[model samples]
Structure formats: C-alpha cells, structure tokens
Target: MVLISLVTGASSGLGRVLAELLCEKGHRVYVIARRKNLLEELKKQCKNLEGEVIIIPGDLSDGNFRKKLISQILKKEKKIDYLFNNAGFGRAILFEKQNKKEIENMFKVNVIAYEHLAALVLSSMKKSNNGRIINIGSVVAFTPLPYFTAYNSTKSAVYGFNRSLIYELKGLKVTSTVVLPARMKTGFAEKAYDCYKEKGRNMCIEKFNKIAESPYVVAKNIIKNMNKGKEIITPTLRAKMWYSTRYFGFVVDFVMKYILGPKERKHLEQAVLKEDYKNS
Candidate 1:
C-alpha cells in the first residue's frame, strides 16, 4: 500500500530532505512551503520517485490556508498515513532583543499550526485506524541555550505535546513520534546566524560545527525508528547523548549557563535595569 504523507516546510532544510526520501520510498507526498519555485524544483528533482508528488504553495502560519490544505488532502485521499510537522525557524538573539512579531510567528508555525494540523488529521486517522505523526524538534528543547530562548521553548512545547499524544492515542493504530536532532548541516544554523549577525551576537560553537550531521542522515534515522514503533527518535549519536543529559537535571543547566553566561549576562542585566528604571 502506498502511504500518503504531508510534509510541511518542504522547500528546504530537513523537511526538504525528508520529503524527497519519502517520495523515493514510494510514498505519495503532499509538500507545503512558501516557495513555489523551490517546490517545483523539488518535483523535478524527484522525477524518478516511485510515488506521486503534490506541491502546495502556502504558509502554515495562515489559518485559512491550513484549512484549505487539510480539506484538499481529505477530499483526495482516504486518509493521511503520516504527518510530519517540520515547519519552524530559529531566532538567534537575546530574549529581550527578540521581536514580538517574530516570536508569535514561531509559535504559530511550531506550536499552533502543528497542533491544529494534528487535530484536523486525527478524525481521518481514527477512521482509518492507523497513522503516524512525526514532529521535528531539536535537542535544544531539552538543553536550552541562550539566544534561542523562544525557539527552544516552542520545541519544548512540541516535546510535551508529543509525549502526551502517546497516551491519548493509546490502543489505536495511530502513534506519535517526536524527533530531537542535534545540529545538522541543513543551512538551518546559517539562517539563524543571519539573525545573530545582525545583532552582533556570537552564537557559534566549534563543537556544533565539528559534529553536525547531514539532513539525509538525520531523516533516514528518524524514518527507520518511526517504522520500528519508536515514539521518540533522536537522530545522531550526539543527539542521543544530549537527550541523556536530561538525566543529570540541573547539571545540564549549570553547564549551559557556564558556557553561555558570561557573554549573555551583561545584556540581560542591562535589560533588567532598564525595566526597573521605568517602574521607578
């Protein structure tokens, strides 16, 4: 049976790699992104894929578009077999420096859109009696770092959602899998750095540059584990190691603060002082 899968943010980065891989595996893929031209290019690149590719050009942040996309999918397919909630971006700036509009946009795509889409698809999934949801999160969800405060929080919300969904869908053929991946060479960081550079922030780490895996490698592991009934997939050895850090609890926090504290403290202190002056 050819499975039907919906992949968001499929025009680039990890989502693009995952969508292409799904096509090659003979799964009918519905890909959504803001870039129509890139989606067209992906279609051409996947010409030899055994399954059909359907491209939808829209923004996940838009409620109307989300409804229309879900409606179109249900109208055409009996049920969506897989839903990959992979549309999200990173903000690399101090928390006080982060834009309110951008923060709302992140939550709209990362949390609200993900949850809404899952609800929309759940009815059909329950009817069909089988489905899988793979939400692409990050290791930062567990190991929070400075500069990515909002991004990390959003992913942590996803982590919590994925965990609770496992119980909610119990006894059904449906399952939820959350993927927490370490740094990967998918240009996600480069985009994040675009924000970092503008703020004159130093968010770079040599370790991430040295050990980051490729998106294809990360996607392959996620699909393989999701197939094997794994509810939480952590791609790459480093990601698994980072996940293990949760066991150490505050030790992880201490280490993060040690690494990031010096550079970020002054900015946070200044912000606090400014707020205090306004109240006075």
Candidate 2:
C-alpha cells in the first residue's frame, strides 16, 4: 500500500531524514517548513527516491498558514495516511529569564500548532483506517532539565497530549506514537551555544558534544519503531534506560538531586545571565 506521509520541520534535522527514508520506502512524502530554500534542496536531493515528494514552506505556528497547508494537501492527495509533528525550537534559559514573546513562541510552535495540525489531518486519517500520528517528544519531558524549563515543559505537554489522544482514539484506526529522544547532534545544540556566545557568555559546549547523537541515527530509529506501530518509542538505548530508571520514584529523586541537579543548576545560572545580557 502506498501511504501518504506529511512531515513538519522537514527543512532539516530528523524530519528531513525521515522524509527521505519514507520516500525511499515508496511512501508519498510531503515536507513542510518555514525555509523555502531548504525545502527545495531536500526535494532535489530526494529525487532518486521511489515515491513522490511535495514541499510546502510555511510557519506551522501561524494558524492561517497551517489551514492553507491542509487545504493544499486535500486538494492534491485528498487524504493523509500519516502526520509527523516534528517541528520545534528551544532556548537554554531559565523560565523566569525567558520573555513573554519567547514563551509564547515555544507554546505556539510546540503545543498549539501541533494540536491544530493533528486535528486538521485526523479526519482523513480516520477515513484511511490505518493512520499514524508520530509526535516527536524528548527525554527531557520525562526528566526535566533546569536550564531547558520551557522546552522540557512543552515536550511534556506533547507527551501528555499523545497519551490522551491515543486513548480517545482507541476504537479508531488512528494510532498516535510519541517518540522520546535524547540530546541530538543537530543544529539545536549548536544554535543554543551560539546564542550564549552571542550574549558574551561561555557555555559548556563540550557537554553537548559528548552525549549528542546523530540526527540520521535518531531518524532511523524513529522510522523503525513507527513501522512496528509502537505507542512510545525511545530512539536511543540511553534514552530508554534513562526513562526506565525515571519511572522508579526513589531512583529518580536521588539522581535528580545528586547526579543531574548540580550541573543543571550551574548551566541554568549561566544561561539565565546570558539571556539577561541579551535583553539588556
């Protein structure tokens, strides 16, 4: 069966890689992002794939843009088999240090937009009777990070949303899978470090360098699990272990206080100071 898949944040990172893999597997893939040039580049590179590829460049955070995108997709394909809500952005700053605009942007992109897009595509998915909704969550959602308060919170919301939505659609053909990934060696960490540097603060870039995994690897794992119809997929072994350990109340509390707490506090202080400098 030829499945029609829609992937948001397909300009780069795991979304782009997943789009390519799905295309190679003979699934019609639609790539959406705000970067037109990058989307075109992806289309060009994916020409060798067996399936069809369509590019729609727009900000998912904009409700009008999402509505337009859905309309366009319906006009072309008439239905969607999969919806991948993968677009997200984050800043490594304390919650108090984050401005109202930044907080709103995070909520808009990570929570509201994803919900709206899923709703928009859900009817068609239900009609297809074998639909999948893959939401890209993070390990931070299970274990909150100090400096990444808003990002972690948003991901937690995604996780909760996926859980509830899956229950609500229990009798339906639609399946919602939430993927929790660890720190990926994508533009995400680099951009956060760059923002810190731009504010004249020296962030511990080496920490990210040590633990971050490749985007391609993460993307591959996500696709592998999605094919198996997993309800919650943790891409890396480390992520799986961490989340598993976190489920134990005493172990999680101990680790949070002794292992991750100090480093997180230090990083958050630096990040908050840097953000303050930028605002000044």
Candidate 3:
C-alpha cells in the first residue's frame, strides 16, 4: 500500500522541506499552506519526485477552512498514513505587548487548528492499523522564556497535549511523536523580526544566527526518527541536552541566569528590538 502524507505550512520552511523530502521518498504528499502561488511553485518543483503532490491552500487559523481542507482530502484519498501538524507561528515579544487578537490568532493556528485536524484524521489513522502523527514542538517549551511568553506557553501546551494523546492512544495502531528543535534558520525568524520592527524594536539577529540550524537538518532528523516510531524527537544536540537537563529546575535557573547571565539577556533584547525596529 502506498503511504499518504499530509503536511501543513508546506509553502516554506521546515514544512516545505519535509514535504519535498517525502515526495522524493515516493509518498503521496498533500501540501497545505495559505499561499496559492507558493504551493503551485512547490507542486512544480515536486514534479520529478517519486510520489504525487497535491496542493491544499487555505488559512489554518480558520475553522471552516480546516474543515473544508479535511473534507476535500477525504474525498480524494481514503486514508492518510501520516498527519504532520507542522503549521504554527511565533512572535518574540513580552506578553503585555501582544494584543488580544494576536494572542487568539496564534493560539488558533498553533493549538486549535492542530487539535481539530488531529481529531478529523484520528479515526481514519486508527482504522489504517499503522499511522503516525508528528507534531512540531519547540525547545523553548522545556523552560520559561520571559520575553517570548505566549509562544513558550503554546509550545508547552503542545508538549502536554501530545503526551496526553500518546497515553490515550497506547496499544492503538496510531502512534504520535513530537519533534522539539531549538532555533532553526527559517522565515519564522524573519517574521518575528518584522513584527518587532513594527513596534520600533529589533530582534537579536546575532544571537539567533549563532544557534539556528537549517530547516533541512530539522526535517531530516524528523523523518529519520519518525520511521523508528520514537515518542519524543529532539533534533539538535543542544536542544537534546537542554531538554535532558530541564528536569533539574534549580540548575536550569542558575545556568540561564548566572552562566548565560543578565548581560546576554539585555544584549539579546536590544539586538532583537533593533532588528525589529529596522525591519519596521
């Protein structure tokens, strides 16, 4: 039986890279994103790939859009072998700085959309007898980030939700895995920078540049671990180490405060604000 894969946020970044890789691996790939032009370009690019590529363009933040997307997918493909809940966005700002609309929109896209889509796909996946759900989480979810409060909270929620779902699905044919990675070099950073600039602040470009990994690397690791049916997959070595030490709260606090220090924090905030301001 041919495996079918559904990937959201597939117009760019990790999602796009992963979709291409999966197409190359001979899996029928259904790519979801808001940009029709970008998705078309991706379809063109995947023409030579082994598997078929289908473009599904719609804003994930809209419930009707998500429902329509699932309905259309079911009409075409009877079952999806893998459901990749990779569509999410984040911002680098203090909690108070973000307004109600922004907060709700983020939650809608990052959390609600995933939950709705997962529920839509679960029954089919369960019936398929072998399927996987890969959720893209973040390392920031492992610890508290003062400035990136909402983003951190959403990721933390994702971690908790995926874990609970895993427990509930125990002994079932469907398996769930959460991919946690540190900063990755993608359009996400640029978007965050743009948002900060609009607020007359700049992002910490240098700090992110130092730690970010390519989206390709993140996608590669995800595919590698997914085949093995791993429960929690942390891509980068630094992220793995950081998550491992998160059990020791005192140590994490001391290290982040003293070792990394206030100086670093100030510098990051300033740099981020400056970049944001310039972009704005």
Candidate 4:
C-alpha cells in the first residue's frame, strides 16, 4: 500500500526536510506552502526518489483554499495516510506593541489553520482508520518568553489540541503527535529577526544563532520516531528541557521577566543603537 501524506510549510526549514525525508521513505508526499517556486524546486530535487513529491502551493490560512486543496488531493490520491501540520511563523514583540492584524493572522495560520487542515485530513484518515497527525510546535510553548507573546500562546494551544486529539483517537491505530523543537537555523529565524527590526526590538539575533540547532538533524530525528507512538516528541535535549519547564510556571515567569524585560531591552538598545533618549 502506498502511503499518501500531506506536509505543510514544506518550502523551507524543517518542513522542507520532512517532505524530503518522507519521500526518501518511499511515501507519496504532497508538499504544501505559499511559495510555488520553492515547492517546484523541491519536486525537481526529489523527482528521482522512490516515492513522489506533489507540490500544492497555497495559503493555509484560507479555509476555502484548505478545503479545496484536500478535496483536490483526496480526489486524485484516494486517502491521506499522514498529516504533517508544520506551517507556522513567530514574531518578536510585546503584546501591546503587536499589530492587531498581525496577531490575528498569526492565530489564523498557527492555530486555526492547523485544526482546520487536521479536520480536513482526518476525514480521510478515519476512512482507513490508519494515519498519523504530526504537529510542529515550539519549545517556547513551555518557556513563554516575553517577546514571543502571541506565538507562545498559539503553541500552548497546539499542545492542548494534540492532547485532546489523542484522547479522541484512542482504540485506533492512528496516532497524534506534537513535536516541540527549540531554536533552529531556518527562514523562521530570518523572518523573526525582520519582525524585531520593524518593531525596534534590537536584541541581536546572534544570540539565537549561537544555539540554533540544525533543521536537517531535527527533522531527521522526528521522522525517525514517526511510528514510535509517542504523543509528544521533543526532538532535542534543549527542547526536552524546555518541555520540562512547563511544570514550573513561576520559575519560567521569573526568568523571562529577568531576561527580556524593559531593563534588558534598554540595555541591549544602548549597545546596538548607542543613543537611546527615553524609549523605556
């Protein structure tokens, strides 16, 4: 039986690697993202693989597009054997400074689209009573750092969503897994840096760069355990540690306040700007 799969955010970073790996595993993979060119390039690169890469480029945030995409896929492929919901982005800004539309789009893409696509894909998975739902979440979901206000909450919602989904999937071979990963070297970081630049949050991106993990390694490890039947996967040691922090909210809050508070931002601003009048 050929495994049919849908992988979101497959244009770059972890999603790209996951799509490639799924192809390498001889699974017929449908790669989805907003970037059509990159998806085409991925298709070309994986054309010779055992399985195939079917590029479906569109915005996941659009409900109509999502329903149509799945309808189109199920029309041709029969049934979806797996759902990899890895499409999400984060921004660095305080809650008060965050744009209303930006935050709304963030939730629309990160949380709303995730569940929407899952529901669409799960319909097919249920027919076979066999499939997997893999969600890409962040370690920040547990840590809750100050600058990542909206992004953090979305991840928390993902964790809860996955847990509830697991309970509902009981007695079935299908499983729901949420992978929590820490800092990774990907376009995600570049976009996050740009978000900070626009908002004047000049905390050097270098700090994250120093500790960022390789998306290739992270993606490989995640796929390695795809059938291990774990409800949650912390792909790296750092991410595992961060997951543990969820139990200690008070400690996390204290550390976050100390690390990215106004005082720390002001101090970093002076070093980067050299002439801060009175923003703090």
Candidate 5:
C-alpha cells in the first residue's frame, strides 16, 4: 500500500528534506509552503522518485488557506497516513522589541495552524484507525531562550498539544509524535534574521549558525525515530540534552544565555537597554 504524507512548510529546511525523504521511500507527499517556485523545484527534483509530490502553496497563518488545503487533500486522497506539521518560523529579538504583527503570525503558524490542521485530519485518521501526526517543535520549547520569548512560547504550545494528543488517542493506532530539533543549518536562521531585519533592527544569529546541524541529517533522524514508534523525537545530541534537562529551569536558562556568544549577548543587552529607556 502506498502511504500518503502531508508536510507543511515543505519549500525549504527540514520540511523540504523530510518531504524528499518520504518521496524517496515510496510515500506520496502533499506539500504546502508559501514559495511556489521552490515547491515547483522540489517537485521537479522528486519527479523520478519512488513516490510523488503534490504542491499546495499558501500561507499557513491564513485560516481559509488551511481549510482549503485540507479540503483539497480530502478531495484527492482518501486518508492521510502521515501529517507533518513543520510549518513555522521565529524571530530573534527581545519581547519588548518584537513586532506585533510578526508575533501574531508566529502564533498563528506555529500553534494555531498545527492544532487546526491536526483537528481537521484527526477524524479521518481515527476512523481509518491508522495515522501518525508529527509536530515539528524546537528545543527552545523545553529550554527557554531569552531573546526568543515569543517563538519559544509558541513551540511550548506545540509540545503540549502533541503530548496531550497522545493521551487523547489512547488505545488507538493513531500516534502523535512531537519532534524537538536543535538549531539546524538551514534557511531557517537566515529567514528569521531577515524577518527581524525587516522590522528595521539588527539581531544576532552567528552563534546559532555556528552549532546548527544539517537539515538532511535532522530529517533522517526524525524518520528513524518515527519508525521506532517513538512519541517524542529528539534526534540530535544537543536536542536530547535539552530534553533530559528540561526540568532544570535555572541551569537551562543559564546555559542558553551563554550559548548566545558575545555578539548575540551584546545585541541582547542593547535591545533590553533600549526597551528599558523607552519604558522609563
């Protein structure tokens, strides 16, 4: 039987890698992303794969788009075997210095879209008695990072949602797995920095880029864990460390702060100072 997978944010990064891997493994993938051109490119690259690629380009933050995406999928496919809620982005900035619209967009894409899409697909999955919902989260969800308050909070929501969903689907074959990945060497950091710059400000991402892992490697680990029947997937050593130390709030916070490096440290200091001055 051919498996059907739906991967959101499949234009780039881990999402794109995951989609490609799925296609290579003979699973038909329905991918969604804002970059239509990149989606086309991905489709072309995977044309000769064992499986196939179906593109649905749209903004995840748009409720109508989400609905239409589901509708289109249901119209074409009978049941979705895998749901990869990998569509999200973050901006590195102090909470007080963040853009309201951007923050809202983060919540919509990271939290709301994941939940809404899961809900829309759950009934079909439950009725079919088979499906895996993979929610792409971040280590920041477990260990909070100072300048990424909004992004971290949204990921925390994803973690909670997936965990609770596991219990909710008790006794069912439908599994909810939350993937908490560490920094990945993908377009993610660049996009986040660009978004922050668009807000007319500078933010530091040098440290993150330094320790980021390969998106292809991350995607491979995620699939490995999925096959292992794991509910919580922390593929990297760094990601596993964050998961293991999740409860050590003070230690994690201190380590996270220092991990920012000097450049980001100075950027944070300046951002906080500016915010304090404005408040005063």
Candidate 6:
C-alpha cells in the first residue's frame, strides 16, 4: 500500500526537499505553498517519479486555505499517513522594532498553521490509528537567538505541541515526531534577511550562511528517523550540540553574545546602541 504525505511550505527549502523525497519513495504527496509557479514546477519535476504530486497553492496562515487543503485531500486519499508540518520562516530583527503584523504573521504561519492543520488531519488519522506528524522545528526552539525572539518562540511552540502530542497518542499507532534542524543552506536565510532589511539597516547573516548544512541531507536524516520511530530528532552534529546545551543558560547566552563570530557580535552591539538611543 502506498503512503499519503502532506508537506506544507513545499515551494522551497526543507519542505520542497521532503516532498520530493516522499514522491521518490513511492508515496503520494500533496505539496502546499503560496507560490503556484514553484509548486507547479515541483509537480512537473516529480511527474515521472514512482509516486505522484498534488499541488495546493495557498497561504498556510489563512485558516480557510488550510481547511480547503485538508478537505481536498480527504475527499480522495481517505486518510493521510504522514503530515510534514514544515511551513515556517524566521526574520532577524530586534523585538521592539518588529511590527504587530509581523509578529502575528510569524505566529500564524509557524505556530497556528501547524497546530490547526494537525488538528484538522488528526481525526482521520486517529480513527485509522495509523499516521505520523513530522514537525519541522529548529534548534532555536531550545537555543533562542537574541535577534530572533519571535521566531524562536514559534519554534518553541512547535516543540511543545509535538511533545504533548506523543503522550496524547499513547497506545495508538499514530505518532508525532519533532525534528530540530541546524542552519540550512536554503532560501530561508536570504528571505529572512531581505524581509528585515530597511534601506541602510542590515541584519548580519554571514555567520549563519557559513555554518549552514544541506537541506537535502537534513531531509534524508529526518526520513530515516521517522522510519525508525524516533520521536525527537536533532539531525546534524551542530544541531545536537546546540540543543544538548540549551539548558546551560549562562554559557549559551555568553556564546550567543560574544562567540557568535565578530560580525554578529558587532551587529548585536550596533542594534543595542540604536535601540537604546531610540528609546531614550
């Protein structure tokens, strides 16, 4: 029997890679994103693959879109075997500088959309007693960065939701696995930086780009762990290190402040001075 997988944010990055991987493995995949062209391109690329791709182009932050997405899937697929809750983005900006709409959008996409979509699919999954919710969280869920406060909060919510789900799913074949990945060499960073750039102002992403890993490799590890029935996964060595030491507040904070590389260090200083001046 073939599996049915739903991957959100499938226009690019980890989500796109995961959708492609699922199709290659003979699983019928439903890819969702705002960019219709990219989703269409992905479907074309997977046309001759072992499985199939169904593209649903819309914004996950929209509640109606999420419902329509699940409704369309349920009409044909019967039950979804895998829910790759991977639709999210991060912007690096000072908390005080972040607009209200920006914060709401972040929560809507990263936290609300994931939870709402999971809830929408859970009924069918639980009734069948066979399904998996693969939550695409980040290491920052545990290790919150200074400038990415709102984004970190959203990821932390993802971790919390998935962990609670595991217990709620006890004695059932249905499971929720949260995978925290390190920095990925994807459009995520570029988009994040671009979103926050205000003429002369800049967000330093040099170090982040430097330490990034291939999303393809990360997606492979996530699939491997999912198959092995793992609940919590930190795929990369760097991700593991960052997550493992999350509890060491003082050390992590120190490292986050002073040892995040000179560029980031300098950026942080400038941000602080600028904020202080504005407030004063």
In model 3, how many backbone clashes occur?
13
In the range 1-280, model 5's lDDT, one tens digit per residue, is 8899999999999999999999999998999999999999999989989989999899999999999888788878888889999998987675776789999999999999999999999999999899899999998887776667899999999999988888888888888999999889887776565332325534445546778888888899988777544678988888898788867877866766676434454555554344433452
Worst 10 residues of 5 by lDDT: 194-203
TM-score for each predicted model, relative to the true structure: 0.88, 0.89, 0.89, 0.90, 0.90, 0.90
Error at 261, model 6, angstroms: 9.3
- Lowest-scoring 10 consecutive residues by lDDT in candidate 1? 194-203
User: How would you encode candidate 2's per-residue C-alpha lDDT over 63-118 as one tens digit per residue?
Assistant: 99999988788788788888999999887765676778988988999999889999
- Candidate 6: count of backbone clashes, pairs at least 3 residues apart or interchain: 0
Clashes (N, CA, C under 3 Å) per candidate: 0, 0, 13, 0, 0, 0
Q: Give candidate 6's whole-model lDDT.
A: 0.85
Off by over 4 Å in 4: 195-203, 260-280
Cα RMSD for candidates in order: 4.2, 3.1, 3.9, 3.3, 3.5, 3.1
lDDT of 3 by residue, 1-280 (tens): 7789999999999999999999989999999989889989989999998987899888999999988888788777888889899988886664555677988998998888888889888988888667899989888787655456788888988888899899878888788888888888777766553322424433455445567888898898898888666779998787798788788989877866776545444554554344433432
Error of 3 at 61 (Å): 0.7
**Ranked candidates, highest lDDT first:** 6, 5, 4, 1, 2, 3
Query: Please, what are the lDDT tens digits per residue for candidate 1 over residues 25-138?
Result: 888999999999999998887888787789999999999999999989999887899999999988666676677999999999999999999999999999888889899988
3 against 5, candidate with superior TM-score? 5
Instruction: Evaluate residue 92 in candidate 4 and report its C-alpha lDDT on the 0 to 100 scale.
Output: 63
- The positional error of residue 191 in candidate 3, measured at the CA in angstroms, is 1.4
lDDT score at residue 175, model 3, on the 0-100 scale: 87
lDDT of each: 0.82, 0.82, 0.81, 0.83, 0.84, 0.85
